[model samples]
Target chain A: MGKKVLIIDDSSTMRKIVTRSLRQAGLDFDTILEAGDGQEALQLLAKESVDIILSDINMPNMDGIEFLRQKSANAAIKSIPVVMITTEAGADILAEAKSLGAKGSIKKPFTPEQVSEVLGGLM
Target chain B: MSWETHIADATVEIFSTMLMMEVSSQPPLTERIKSHQDSVTGMVGMAGLYKGMLAIHAPSQVAMTITGNFLGLEVDSVNDDVKDAMGELANMLAGSIKAKLSDNSKDIQLSIPSAVCGDSYSLDYQPQQGSSMVPFESAGGRFLVELQLEQQT
Candidate 1:
C-alpha cells in the first residue's frame, strides 16, 4: 500500500492530471478519493483518513483556503500533509496558504517530475 | 516589431514544444476566421509587464485529443483531466512566452490561468485595433494563438 491520497478540485480534469502525474511518478496509493470543493472534501475527511491531500485554490462550494482553515481547526485532519497545486502564485496568497498548514506548493503547468519533487519530499 | 510577428514566434515555439506541431505559416486573419474552429476554448488572461492570454480553442474531438496527449492517456471523452491539461497548457505557454519576452521586457507579472469553453468565443486586449493572430494545424486539430497587448507608448 502506497498511501491514501485526497484530491480536492472543482475541475475533474485537473484532478485526473494530478492523479496521472502521481501514478507516472510511481507514487503508489492504496486509496485515492476526490472532491469537487472544500466542503465536499471536508465531508469525505470526516469519514475517512488520508495520508496526503493535493488541492486547487479556486472552487465553487468552498475554496482551498477555507479547506485549509477547516482542516486546521480539526486536529485529526490538520496533521495530514497538504500539497496545494494551484495557479495562484501571489506572495500574499502563498504566505496565507503556508500559514494554513500546507505542506508545500506547486504551480500550474507542472510536470510529473515537478509533482514528484514537491510531494515526494513531504510524503 | 509587430504584434503579428511576435505572436508568430511565440506560437511557433508553443506549438512545437507543447503540442508537438509545426507552423508552416503565420496564416492571415481571414483564413483564421474561416477555419472550422473548435466549439470549446480554454482562455487565460495576464497583466502587468506582460499581458494577454494563451487560448486553446478546439472542437470537442480536438480538445479531447490534445488533453489526452498532454496527460499521456487514451481519452475518448472530455473529463476533468482533459480540461485541466488544456488549462495547464495555457499556463505553461503563457509562462514560456513571458520568459521569452524577458529579453525585451523583464519585469512582468503573470496572472493565474483562467479558462472558458463554449461553441464560439473571442479574446482580445484593450487599446484596441492592434492584435496578433497565429493559426496552427496539428495532429489533434486546428487551433489559433493570439497575442493581444498594449505597450506603453
Candidate 2:
C-alpha cells in the first residue's frame, strides 16, 4: 500500500481513535491527513494525493455522502478508495454509500481487529 | 415504545457491542449509579416527538477503562474518547427508539449529544406534561436515560 491516508470526520475524538487503530493495525503511512468535513476533505484532496480515504457519513458543513458524490463525479479523485466509518448501520445509508462507489465500510464502536480486517482488503 | 423497553434494549446493545460485555439490568433494588466527585457523562435530549434525555454517566476510572478499550489506547484520564462514546451511545439508543416508535421521523429531530461531568451536579428537569425516567446500568457503572414522550402522538 502507498504511504498516505486521509481521515475525514467531524469528531476529533473519533479521528484520534481511528489514527491510533491505524497505527496499531500496522498500516504504516508516511502521511496521515485530517479533515473535519467533506468540504474540507475535498479541499485537501484537491491539493494533495492520498492512497486511501477514511471518512464518516454524518457531519456538518458537508456529509460523507455528498463528499463521495462529488468525488465520484470528478475523474481525477474517483479512483481512490473511500472507506466509511460510521455509527449508522441503516440499510438505506449503506446501500447509498456503496452505490456511490465506496470501497468498504466499518461500523462505529469497532475494534482494532475489525479495523484491521476491513482495511486489509483495501490497503 | 415504552421507557422500559427502550432502557432494556439500549443497555443490552451498548454492553454487547461496545464493551464486549454482557450486563443484566438488576432489579429495582439495584443501586442507582451516581459517580464520584468529578466524573463525566454524555447526554442527548429530544424535545419533539419524545421529550426525554439520555445520559451516559461513568466514574473517571470506568470512563478511562471504557475509553482505552474503545480507542485502543492506554488512556489514564477522561478525555474526548469518553465523552464522545457516551454521547454517541445516547444517539444510537435514541435512534433505535425512534426507528421502533415511528413510521417516519420527518417531524422529529434530535439535538446533538453533549458532555457534562464534575464533582457537583444537579439537573432540575421539570417533568414534561407526561414523561418518565428510564435508567441504564452496565457492568462498570450506571447512567439514566429518561423519556418524556407525550408529544409523539
Q: Pick the candidate with the highest DockQ.
A: 2
Q: What TM-score number comes out for model 2?
A: 0.73
Q: DockQ of every model listed? A: 0.15, 0.26
Off by over 4 Å in 1: B1-38, B44-54, B75-132, B147-153
- Top of the candidates by lDDT: 2
Residue lDDT tens for model 2, A63-111: 8899999999999999999999975566667688999999888877676
Report the C-alpha displacement of residue B143, candidate 2, in angstroms.
3.5
Highest TM-score: give the candidate number. Answer: 2
Local accuracy of candidate 1 as per-residue lDDT tens digits, B85-116: 66666665565565555533225555445566
**Per-prediction TM-score to the true structure, in the order listed:** 0.70, 0.73
Model 1 B-chain TM:
0.73
How displaced is residue A113 in candidate 2, in Å?
4.5
